[model samples]
Target: MREVVLVVLQLARMTVTDLLGSLNLPEEHIQYWLNRNEALHNFCSQNETCYSKYELNNKQCWGYEASCSKKDSFSARKAKCTKPNSWQKQIFKKQADFAKLAEVLSTITPICVSNYSEGSSLECSSHLRFCRAKNIFFDFHNLNAKNSKRYRNDVIQKGQAGGNCNMLFNEAALRSRADEKSYLQSWAHELEHFSSYPTFEVSKRQCDVIFEKPTVLIKLDAASSMYHHFCDFVNLYASQHVNGSVDMDIDILWWDTVSFLAAASPKPLIIHYARNCERASEPSALATVIANKNCG
Candidate 1:
């Protein structure tokens, strides 16, 4: 039975590889897929029970959800080690392998970028004030003194005071600081160590259910002054689509973000900036355009 399954997987891989080749993907992509597929086939054959537990739909293997978590119980971790070919490994490898390809695929003409009503700087200011209010006694001066030299320098260079927005503060330090002032200062000190900006948050909305083909919806907030940060976030998000599907809808709330830049400069000037940004061989020109015109 296992022999038959192995043979079938071999044929399927060959067929899929040929189909992928027809799509004109890079040779490296095809080779990488072939190698990974072979590993998958071998694992399935060697451990039929575990392979049987995984979900398969439309020729895509969606590995078990329970195996995806790193914080799983000891028993779950033991199972993962015993099995060795868990879905979490597959997800990480797939994401890493296709990240660069996803970026290039995003630039394809099939992508539709549209702007909605302008975002409000007032709302952004409100958010910033709220953040400040919540940590009312957060002394940047005190925190700066306590932080490491590297962290202090980074905070000075980039206006980023907090570490990555998604990460949690140190539990030990957070617990140790008895007073609110000390606690908040410790929090600020940790935040400077990481560079994370929340200029825009990307969410996929109804693309899977509404579109016939695979479509991605990227929502960018216009209220953000972080145009350069938005580009970085977009590039990171784009790298996740390993399948090379290019049909994308980018919905931008344009007021404070895109329109703010547009309002300051003439159409001809913006166009010149865009041309200079495109023609420049290095990132310096792009950086200049982004800083001066805020349109890159």
Candidate 2:
């Protein structure tokens, strides 16, 4: 029985239904054989050229088609596969937008904070207030600084702050009395959130940045770390929010992040702003654009 099954599977043209019907197998046995045949077919289709060539030759090739050998001419057409569909074109546009944003971010000076003597909670609150007054969206976690050690310990253990926003730094992380460069980088990280100027919601992951007038939700992934996870998050966010009519954008700062997202999530407009502590010394293109256009 095993030998017969093996021979039947080796024959590419033989269908499981026909094989089972001819064998007069029991109903239960027929189902088992059918399943095995399907598994074998799938495996061969992936790993064996005979199956792939047969399938490809039968289908109408979408992109640029190249000729194969004469013997297998029926299945010899090779698709160029380079031409992106409408969805792919949109992703490319988003990636380009991100690159432009990153260029702007790289040039802007970091937000200056002279002192942390009063603690970062107060400063954070002040920054938020300033943003609110200016019609910018900025959220601060651990607003009260209720437990500094707890926040630090939490960050250390979890590798992230206890909140959703990208600017999830604890008071300790903020108050370490780091150099001006570190402070500038941190401020840049926060300010970059407003580079695109979308309204933010209280939701942890879903619809973080919301544009009310336009009814668009922007997914924010500010942490420059974890490229793959960020891409996954962008894809998941788009799947949840983007309907046919709704607008969406995935905002990112790191060039690396933008590159990953470009390949991963092609639906959302990825706004990129590549900047960090090392690049703080340079003049920001974002600032220049704001200065010339009189907008943030």
Global lDDT scores for all candidate models: 0.22, 0.24
lDDT of 1 by residue, 1-296 (tens): 11100000000011222232232334333322322344434443455553464332222211212222333221223333334566865444344322223223332221011122111010001101001101100012222222223213122122322211232233233223212211112222222222323341111220111111111111223334687545534432332223212112211111010112321112212211111101111100000101111111
* Model 1 global lDDT (CA atoms, 0 to 1): 0.22
- The candidate scoring highest on lDDT is 2
- Least well predicted 10-residue stretch by lDDT in candidate 1: 4-13
Give per-residue CA lDDT, model 2, range 1-296, as digits (tens): 11100000000112222231233333333222322234433543564543443342232221111221222322122312255345644444334222223223223222222122211111221122111011122232212233222112111111111122223233443333221212112222333222221122223232233222211112233345686355445433222211111112222222121223443223444222221111111000111111111111
The alpha-carbon deviation from the true structure for residue 50 of candidate 2, after best TM-score superposition, in angstroms, is 21
Where in model 1 is the C-alpha error above 4 Å? 1-18, 21-24, 35-209, 219-296
